[model samples]
Target: MGAFGRNHARVYQQLQQAGSVRLVGVVDPDTARADAIAREFGCKSFGSVEQMLTTHSEVQAASVAVPTVLHREVARALMEAGVDVLIEKPVAATLGEADELLRVALEHKRVAQVGHLERFNPAVRATLPLINRPMFFEVHRLSVFSPRALDVDVVLDLMIHDLDVVLTFVKSEVKEIRAVGLPILSGKVDIANVRIEFESGCVANFTASRVSTERVRKLRFFQAGQYISVDYARQDVLVCSVGSAVGAAHSFATDANEWGTRPSVNPQIQMAKPPITAEEPLLAEIKAFLRSVRDRSRPAVSLEDGRKALELGLAILAEIGRHAGRIAVGKG
Candidate 1:
């Protein structure tokens, strides 16, 4: 099992201890790794999905944390075998692969979820109620370089998380995109900056870097007369509003004393921190997946939602490619 696969197993084991679900098994091509994680989680391990299915014929659902290219293959097999699946992000390597996965899920009537983990973050959940005609957004997700997740560009590996969140917040179709990226530490793009304009006149700027010295995960947006800041790592939201904007967010201002408030340097501006119920995002995401599986309901982050994010991510990559071409031409 890889890093994220082990995390899924751990969370499943935690759920099992609480009597929510059973930890059926873990699968990895590397038998030793699979066996290790299985032992750590107190479950069985198999070298492949087929081996696991052969032993646990009644497996109801599975988390496909395999590489992006193998996502469709593994997930298709599970759905065909009557097992719901939660596929990790960038749903698939290409849109064609994503479409095929979607078709298979529809045909099998499987409850497929995507691992857009940020959607379930306490801060993001807490900020949903505060959305009011968001017009502009600034997001940054930086990480220290690691060999992990180098198969994809930083846009897909890191920025896609913000893409999904912003898409959810804006709820509008993208109208245009401008992007630039570079390969610093990896053959693929290690850092990227993108600006997107939505059909509803909303604009979002995103910066993602896997070569950063310090880690930062934050998103700030401005609506009509209010500015909202979300610290994803800290699971906190800060809102600054004026006049009518403050009135609209009054319900969330009750805990200003507890959450600490910023003194209004400007007589017209007031700042407050929305009450956030901190819960491990992965736990919430997996719980939601199970609930969808049990109730045969829609997942919190459906495959379609994941596809939308991927579509935008791919478009940004395209823009980046074009920008790089222009630079090369100028150099020539």
Candidate 2:
């Protein structure tokens, strides 16, 4: 467990109390770090996944929270042992690694999950029923400078969540990608802007920055005659509609605009706040993973889904580099 691993450990412990699964063991290469987190969560610690699995053969499922590079190795070992896994986001460091993880999971028939926590967000779940030909999206995920996750750029660390969500929503092939990024506080790209066009003619613009002064996480989209907004931090969703008056306004729709009292060209507007049952996204993800393991069913965020997100992330990184080279040549 490193920066985000403590949170994973905490959620697993919470899951232990709330359900049938138990937190059997936590493994870390650093014995001290593993012991500290284990003690905090009332679980045992081991030097590695092998040691843990050797001692605790009853372990059926695990959360692979290792670093980006170690994901393939850690997850491969677990799956090979016939254990289901919920590997954390970015799935793997590269597309090849991601594909291998998927292959192993399939060959082992293990329940594999990708840690796209936002997929379980109450706001996102609530907004799903409201989707209808989403034409455009504007997403922003900003955070104040943090030393954690500096190993990778903001594209993988922060923007990938939105990328996964948008890809799920659009369900279309990416046709074009234009991106720009620069390093600020870290050696990796600390801030980035991306514009993606999909085969469905949908367009999305994303902005992610780890060197921001304020924290903001929100996504807003426009569809045909409707606008929807999602607040990730607050777990809230707001849907505004045009050309379709709903609920109580349905009775008055035909009266006002049709009687010549108002312009017929303008349609009555309606706004609705979809009801949401808010829960910790991580907890929900763990619960879902455990359920998948027990039932041997596909996870909500499957390996293929994670791979697609990683592919897009890698593509965006390449596009950023290409743009940087163009800018440098122009400057020269």
For lDDT, the strongest prediction is: 1
How would you encode candidate 1's per-residue C-alpha lDDT over 1-332 as one tens digit per residue? 79899999999999999999999899999999998999899999999999999989999999999988789999999999999999999898789989999999999999999999999999999999999889899999999999988888999888999999999999999999999999998999999999999999889999999999999999999986689999999999999887763444432344557333543333367799998889999999999999999999999999999999999899999999999999999999
Candidate 2 wrongly placed segments (more than 4 Å): 243-267
Q: Write the per-residue lDDT of candidate 2 for residues 104-218, one digit (tens) a residue.
A: 9889999999999999999999988888789899999999997787667889989999999999899999999999999888988999999999998889999999999999999
| Poorest stretch of ten by lDDT in candidate 1 | 258-267
In candidate 1, residue 43 scores what lDDT? 90
| Sliding window of 10 residues with minimal summed lDDT for model 2 | 245-254
TM-score per model over all chains: 0.93, 0.92
Compared with the true structure, model 2 gives a TM-score of 0.92
Q: What's the count of clashing pairs in each model shown? A: 0, 0
For each candidate, C-alpha RMSD in Å? 6.0, 4.5
Candidate 1 Cα misplacement greater than 4 A, ranges: 245-266
